[model samples]
Structure formats: structure tokens, C-alpha cells
Target: MFFEEHTGLHIDDQRYRGSGTSKANRMRGFWTVEPDHVVARVLLAMIAHATEYECVPADMDDALFADVHRIIARLNQNPSSPVPEVDAFTASVNELDFEAAAKHIRTAIEQNEPATAWIACTCFR
Candidate 1:
């Protein structure tokens, strides 16, 4: 819903391809020209949306929040770093507990820190 409403990207559950390799150990799923570019785009879009409107209520889950935080911390650590290792980053993202991340986002919104929430959520996405 958020992607559709904010970025016009209507990605459904079925379209969410799994990360990692296939049965043959070959990588699968779509590969962008630059993975970091994709991340930047999503983050920017999220920030723009959050800035333009009131905070929207979202689920807050613990495990997911931890994963999101991990990702964001990595990104923030070296904002100018070249495109990150796609496989490693994807692995980290796949390990996230979506429920926990949702909880974290909700907490951020409740605290009126929508920008932080947006960065976390977008990183996971």
C-alpha cells in the first residue's frame, strides 16, 4: 500500500521474489544496474512522502526493526561507498523479521520521527 500510494510501485506479495540462489546455486531475481541507486531512490521517495504529509500509522515489530536498523546503519556508515555487495546486503535483508521492523516504524511515528522511520522502512523494502 505504501509503495503504491507513495512511489506508484504496485508490488504485490506474489511479485516479491525471494533472495539468494536457486536450486543450482545460481543467483536469481532481478538485478538492477546499480543496487545502491535502487536504495537511494526508495529512500528519497519515502522521505518526500513523509515530508509532505502527516505521519501514517504503521505496524511496529521488534525483529524487523532490528534488521532494518542493521541495514540503515550499514548504509549510513558510508553514504559515499560504492554500490554495496549485493549478495551480502540481500542476505541481511532476507534475514530480517518484518514484524519487528514494523514495530520499530510505529514507534518512530509515535515519537514524531517519521523521517527516521521512513529511512528504516525504506531500507528494508
Candidate 2:
């Protein structure tokens, strides 16, 4: 919901391209961020560097870091589904081993782990 509100693009609407449905007809389709979108790729790279160095980039301010931490906190609330990589990433962040955290984040993304990737993306975006 936050993403939809911020991006003005619904995830569900991504499926309606060329469907000719009324809702799809009324609005543009394929507007949602794709996993391989340029913005996502650029952010991921920045996150990797920042995490590796354990220092926020000059362009990324304190407020962005706070938002990232908030997102991570929300994700941590749901521990029923155990993801070892996510757990390790969180630990890396806590220990200030940003490079290790970046590694874990990359793995999470490669594994199609949206929650983990979302945390990193939101932080940098």
C-alpha cells in the first residue's frame, strides 16, 4: 500500500497489459517497478556500497537511514517465516558489517525475496 500510494502504480495493475479490461483500458499498464528496473538496479548498487562500507553515502541523509531502520523493524515483526539470509542481514547491519549485510541483501534479491530487497531499496530510494 505504501508503495502504491508513493509510486501511483499498483502491483496488481502490472498484470493487465493488453488485456483490454475496463480498468486496464482506463489506465496505463506495466507501470509498476520491475525487479530489473534501472532505478532498482542503481539503488541496489548504492546500497551495496553503503552497506559494505558501513557508512551512508553523502547523498543519503539521516532521515533515509531512519526510514530504512523502520522498514527493517516492520519486517522483523513477522518472524513466523524464517529466512536465514534475512536474519543474517539484520545481524550484519547490527554489527556494522555493511559489506556482509550487502552480500546477504544481494542473495536475498537473487532468491526473489522481496521483503529484504524492499528494505534496501526503500532505504536508498
Candidate 3:
């Protein structure tokens, strides 16, 4: 509903199913086709719609901002194994590379999390 209402992109069930072959995968395939910013914006909108608390990423504090990105990264990750993004995230933590870890989190959120969240929105609607 949000995708069509806001972004004008219809979610065909078959096509969407292709995005995540199984329920456990959390829909990583959306990034392979859609633009990152678009997916992020749609996810943000859906969050605002459901929570009634809109977030402006620029207005978030540094820690809060990074935390949100990390949350998103975690949600998008496969439960069965570590993906490259998760590996990089773990390496950054092991090396105490705060900036690199933050970058990895942000990139993972931008590329994967939002799209997966958008798909999850279907359950509610």
C-alpha cells in the first residue's frame, strides 16, 4: 500500500516472492533491482505511518543515528549465516574501527534493510 500510494510501484506478489525465495531470507534481493535511496525512503515512510513518529535522519544524534542504522542492518541479515556486510561489520568491531563500522552499518541499511522492511509491511496491510 505504501509503495503504491507513495512511490507508485505496484508490488506484484510473484515478483515480490522472487525477492525472497523463502520466508527466512528477509528479502535481500530488492537491492539487486531497486535504487537504495528509494527503498530507504519507502521504508522510512512505512515506519512513520505505522509508528506515527516520523524520523529525519539528519536530525538524529550521532549515537542514535548509528544505532538506527545498525538495527536496520541486523534486521536485513540472514539468520542462517553471516553475509559480507555482516562480516565487514564484525571485522570493524573487532578492529575497533568505529568509523568503518558506522559506514558498514549505514551502507547495509541503505542497501538492504529498507527494502526488506518495505516487504514486511505487507503483513500489516
Candidate 4:
């Protein structure tokens, strides 16, 4: 267990050993809570965790970037579906606006097609 070994300390190795930059990025979006304004602290318990499979392998590229955008779109959707971060994310959604990050998310999906779903999932998170 890399996590156990690195408890309170940064091991920065394995699977992502030499790819902290990408790994740092791909690690986000573990949450799946639906959208809502005035985010509720009560939603903190819903945080989701990405699986090792969902970690987005160190080998990512343009196409993979595109897929990440798609995930952002879905996350931006405020869909009826509920995920862990939905509420925590909603609180920040308003702040995250203006940048139109959601638009970027869509563009990444439409323009690039190779981006993996996991990358997209991490994009917004």
C-alpha cells in the first residue's frame, strides 16, 4: 500500500512515480455529487474516490485531454444523478464560473475525441 507507506509524508512514487504532474491532475474528481448553488457542508460525506483503474495512466495525450473535457461537461451538467462531490462542488461551481470552464470542458470533448473519461472526471475536480 503506497498510501499507507506515505501516510503524512509524500512518497511520490509507484504507478505515478515519475509522473506527479499528470498524477496530480488525474487524481481529482473522485467526487460525484450532483450540482446545487450555495453548496451545503452536509454534502462533505459524499466525496468519491477514483479507482486505480480510474487513475488515468501516466501515458496521456491530446485525445486523452479531450476526454477529460467531456467529464467536465457531465460534471457541469448539474445532472439529476448524484455523486459524492456534487454538493461540495456546487458550492464552488459559482466561483468557478466566469472562467467558463464548462465551455472548455465541452470543447475538449468535441474537439479532441481521444481524451479518456477518467481525465475528464478529474478535469473539474
Question: Where does the lowest 10-residue lDDT sum fall in candidate 1?
Answer: 23-32
23-113: candidate 1 lDDT, tens digit per residue: 2221123223224334444555665576478453366466875675577555444434432232132233545566566667666655545
By lDDT, is 1 or 4 better?
1
lDDT of each: 0.49, 0.50, 0.51, 0.37
By TM-score: ranked, best first: 3, 2, 1, 4
For candidate 3, list the clashing residue pairs, or say none: none
Model 4: which ten-residue window has the lowest total lDDT?
37-46
- Which of the numbered candidates is closest to the native, going by highest TM-score? 3
Instruction: List clashing residue pairs in candidate 2.
Output: 51-98, 52-99
lDDT of 4 by residue, 12-125 (tens): 333333434454432322121212311211122111123334655457686966775565555445534333332233424466562454445444444433233225546656
Which consecutive 10 residues in model 3 have the weakest lDDT in total? Answer: 84-93
Residue-level lDDT of model 3, residues 1-125, one tens digit each, is 65678677655445556546663232344545455455565566666775575545555677975786675555445444323333332332245455544554555454556445444333223
For model 2 the local lDDT of residue 45 reads: 49
Residue-wise lDDT of candidate 2 within 66-114, one digit each (tens)? Answer: 7865654454344344444444433433555565556656766556565
Off by over 4 Å in 2: 1-28, 31-33, 36-98, 120-125
Comparing candidate 2 with candidate 4, which one achieves the higher lDDT?
2
Instruction: Please provide TM-scores, in order, for all candidate models, with all chains considered together.
Output: 0.26, 0.27, 0.36, 0.22
> Which structure among the candidates has the greatest lDDT?
3
